[model samples]
Target: MTQSPAPLPPPKQRRHLREAASLTQAQVAERMGVTGETVHAWESGRTTPRGRRREAYAKLLASLTKADMVTNTQEAAPPPQVTVCLNKKPNPRRAVSAPTPAPITPTPITPAPITSAPITSTTRTPATRTPASTSAPVAVAAHGPVPASETEPAPLTPLTPAQAFDALYAFCAPALVRQTYLLSGRRELARESVEQAFQLAWQRWPEVAVDRDPAGWVRATAYEYALSPWHRFRPRYRHPEPPPADASDRALLDVLLTLPAPYRRTLLLYDGVGLDLPETAAETEASTPAAANRLLNAREAVAARLPELANPTALHRRLAELASAERLRAAEPTTVRAGSERRARFWTRAAVAFTVAIIGATALTVRTAPTRYEPPVPPGETVQGIPPRSAPGTLSDAELKLRAKLRSGILHGPQRLIPLAE
Candidate 1:
């Protein structure tokens, strides 16, 4: 008896799906809006996603795994080729001036039996058709036999909102991260920006999935998030290594980095990420004409260093190919450590408290602070120095007492002077 392969354990299965999707536990947690421990628990089989969460979990796994399977199958299978026969055999019954046959009375005819022989055309010109045994019917046109390579598979049926989101994430996440990386010049930040954008997209997927260009919407959202100034206050990005780069790419990147931010982003969008001028402008928040001008200027800047890139067409093509190859590995989210969220919460509360304290202190100081101080003076009192009045011609009782005290040496200075108003 043949032995069957062992089924994957729950933890292994969960890890396999996560890794296959190029996602980290933190990313899954963020998508599920749960803590990393919850995801870990589910993956470890200590717990399982239940109810609607289970439904979502299954959908996520199916979408990513299916996408990978499709890609792999396509890569492994070779394209089908159809052999076209050019020789046209003349019909033995056909004559240059054969008289038309008369119409006979209608009669019931037995259907011909299916045969193994190749089906041939009854007309003067013989048509080539594949034998039924070989493959499905090859679509033939009146003009000529259609090449097998020309045929395309039927488009996929519309997916539900959740499936659509998962599919979108699987298909576009890597590409989106690459585009954002080229724009931001930071690999980890690029990933975060894309993740944040995808998070937003997941929340509003009903509107996003139905858009004409869902990928474009995601990319645009990422670009906007990457450029946001508030991103600085968030945890800094850390990565094991930078995205791979070749000599030519490194050279181009070095030169590209020298360009101003607007020009750099415009160039990357137009050439690297393959956005059109209008889309680029919309993403960069500029007009089409302005985008065109920036692109022209950016190309000139790049061409100045790499003279071979002077041709706009060649430059766009080369840059687009180079940039599309940069698939960033999902960085392990470091900030998701236990209690980090709690720490963040605590800091947030602390910051609010600090702000309130500062404001209260400022208001109290303003309310209680003394205004420009001035000594109070009796009403009608002259604040100015007055010249001493002429000595009194006659001494009053107080002056007599002062004189006696002065004579007795009890008084000093000018008061002790004799003839004190005598």
Candidate 2:
């Protein structure tokens, strides 16, 4: 019966071993004849290797573990120091009478433990070694005490939020501005994009500070802002910025602008920024093959127009030179941080005001509204209580006589006359 296979280390230990060996997942995958994703899955415990592959991976991890052990052991031991003594010819009588002194052995000092207290400069005095006897010279080999600063480095103080934000801005803003210029071909817009990206970073410092790659976060933001199609609609950016003064530079910028935005970004990230294909793909939000295709297309377009830049080295150099020549500058970190805070305050106040206005309108409507519902009255119908007036016709004999009497009696004004009966 075959022996059971050896158990593998835990998933976390497997990843740590690989990192200790300074090997990337892709590198390990290539050696193991598997896809990078497979190695990633193995490390992440999503899947396990089987058969010969399992045996091979176990062996690889074992070797890495042994290597790490050896390295740690070597680092822990202090180096030995040797002192040689030179002596002149001794008198025979004196040499015989004097006893040979025992060699001095220096005691090793244990390294100091690190603490969180602030580091201060202090003078260190070296301990002098004493020999057993002064009559005869003796060579001594001993380990010197390691310097406190070297053995136990002071722990770094954690940066405050503002300090961290400023540091990140100072480190990335200048280079990002240059990169944005290549993406958009507008110096002013490039500056604006970098500033806007920093402002956004300041607004979300907590998220950005804890990110694995804060520079990449800001870079992606700047690129997205710089290459926004909405910029085309802005009156200031509707017309293209003036081309570079040099004819070659002008041709290069024109060619870069001709490519699709995605292709241009991929090319710049891969070639100009010195990022590998995988990283460029991740940043551009595309697959490795798609990013490669875009890069190829972009390079071909540029090479067709400017054949001198056909080589990637030459192209990268040209891109760098082109960007450096432009007068791109980023706003101060303090300014960007203040602006972000101001913008946030403005929006917050506006929201509060809008809510208050809505509440007031609701209250006013409630107060003025008719509480009780009243049914409207319908139109009145004609009543038949009074008979309709008779139309003009020949009067009866009695009616005519009465009318003539009334007309004759009431002629004088103030007299009250009674109606006469016919």
Candidate 3:
């Protein structure tokens, strides 16, 4: 029978051992004749090594573990000691000249009477002040020299919420306005977008202040606002803005605008802003490969339009120049903050009014509505009478004869007897 192979440590342990041995995944993969991704998979426990590779990886891990143990032991070992001659018998011969003199007793002095001086309020002075004269030196001597630590400058106090917000706005607003201008060809819209973004940031300063990248937060907001589809429908933005005065700038801007919105944004983030691929993908909310494709397509389109911008460096430079050539200034931080507050109040009031209106309408409907259901009366129908009436026809012969006799005789016999009907 064949001998059984040794069991390997857990994946986490294997990774720890490799790292403790100062070996990267790539280095381990190279040694193991496997790919770095394979090693990563193994370390991450996503997949396990198998067959001969497993055995070899196990041996490598064991060796690393042993080496790590040895290193730890060495580090934990005590330091070596050295002997000193001062503790030896050298003092017996060298210091035998005379017995050591006894230390003299210190003389006791009476304490002076303490005098309490009236406290006076004085204005503060600078930490480092020059001595006015020899007479001023008395105060210094009385206090003794200030310690080096005390003379050192104090640490800075943390910034207040408003100050911090203002600083962040001042630092990022100008560049953000320029970036927004590139995103949206309209300078006025660009300025408005940036101011709006900062206003939002100020409104959410608590969340934004704690965020890792406040500028990135603001940039994303501004970009979203600048590229909003609603802007096209607005009357102010219905008409296209005037092109740049410079011919080259106009041509470049036109080309940039021709590309699709996502592709343009991805290209600007990657090339214009100099963000790496992953960061660009993150900001644009696209996969790395997708962002890469967008960037490639955008660059190709621009190059097709203006061959001079084929080089990425030239493209970036041209984009920067194009954005800078346009004068886009952002609103003041105070103005933005004030606008945000005012907008917030207006919306809040509008919401309250809407809620009140809804409640009143509901109350009115409930009050006016019928309390009980009433079935509607059915439509009228014709009913037969007790005796049915017959249809009329021609008169009888006898009746017709009598009618004719009366009409013929009535003119002469009205005064005489009228009993002639038989």
Candidate 4:
């Protein structure tokens, strides 16, 4: 008798299902509200789905494969009617029936026919689980494949950008928040930026997943979005940072926001994206020299605006800092205005009024007081850095003319930028 081959992986089934449904790892997490790593573990069979999720995953696959079958049927035979045998959920009934096989061959039950449109990967999620590396159970045929089992189970699946970023943020939101807070001068905008950036990342999971630096992509995107002028017009809400899910969460996003758009854009490409000037130029659609000039000018302008922060001499400045989710999501829509700035404005106006009162008082005091002068000396002797009149005890004609000319300046209104002498 031919020995039965090892149970095969649903490789073709999975590939087709993935294509038909366009499920990315990020979308998988978004669908299930789980981490990206969890989906990786599921595809690798490190963990298994339970309860409603197990049914969701199985149903998604079944429906997707069936849809593909309908499309391919234009030139080929239709898929044979499939009797989907669902696995039993954990329960006491299963314990009672655990050892009992059906008494004999029983009639198969017909599952309901499904006709939903293909769910976009951005919206729907795949079954996700954590890797059970230490005690992984062997996967029996999941009703997906029963025909081929030649090679080792096709190497575990890959994650899409959306999925990877979802995983990264799931693991590192807190730190991202803290970093974002430090990067952004204000907290509310940073928190929203992080959240919005991750949401966008999920929408484009495939391309993002394969990207060399998805975290960088997300960060760059977040900063750019926060820097948009429209963001300012909209009333900002608050969400504090939480415990970070990963190490890369430590990037400060607020600093980029503090700078002008042109400078921030330059910094995002050259620094945040880790591109050299030429690559930055290409990515930003500018010439290399122009990119380089922008970066330099931006840096100079940013430094000038924040002298204390620009200090290269301050070696203790951390290149990275850790943050957590609790903090990222903590700030509410309120509590952003600086107390000092508000108070300073009020005090400044008060001080101007006070100065005007003092000016009036001084004018009254001057008018009420009498003026006096001292006796003049001989012409040869100097009095207050000036020649005295020629006659003793009397002012000379030339001395009187000079003193009057000097007093004319203070008696007049302010002079023009061009010299009065001119």
Q: Who is ahead in lDDT, 1 or 2? A: 2
Instruction: Arrange candidates, best lDDT first.
Output: 2, 3, 1, 4
Candidate 4 stretches with Cα past 4 Å from truth are 1-165, 171-183, 210-213, 237-258, 268-275, 282-285, 302-326, 329-422
C-alpha root-mean-square deviation, each candidate: 25.2, 12.5, 18.8, 24.2
TM-score, predicted candidate 4 vs. hidden true structure: 0.32
TM-score of each: 0.41, 0.60, 0.58, 0.32
lDDT of 3 by residue, 93-152 (tens): 553332222222222211111111011111111112222222221112233545757644
**Candidate 4 C-alpha RMSD relative to the actual structure:** 24.2
Candidate 4 residue-wise lDDT, 1-422, digit = tens: 96433332364455345544446556655676655544444554434666666667666667777776764563264323333356755453542312211111112211111111011111123333332233232333665645546423554555543344444654334444544554454567777776666666655656666564555566567766666667545544344334245433322333444566665566544543233455466545678888888887766664665554454322113223222222345222112123323555787899999999999999999998869866788579535966756756667898899778667645445764333663
- Predicted candidate 2 versus true structure: per-residue lDDT over 1-422, tens digit per residue: 98787678998799778766667666787799865545655775656888889999999999999998976675466534333334565555753333343333333221111111000112122222343343443333345444556634355566678877876676567777888888898989989998888888888888887665677788899999999889888898888777889998888888998899999999888778666577678889999999999999999999898999999989988888888777777889999999999998999999999999999999999999999999999999998889998889998999999789777778567767776666
lDDT of the candidates, in the order given: 0.61, 0.74, 0.73, 0.49
Model 2 poorest ten-residue lDDT run: 111-120
Better of 3 and 4 by lDDT: 3
Clashing pairs in 3: none
Error of 2 at 196 (Å): 0.8
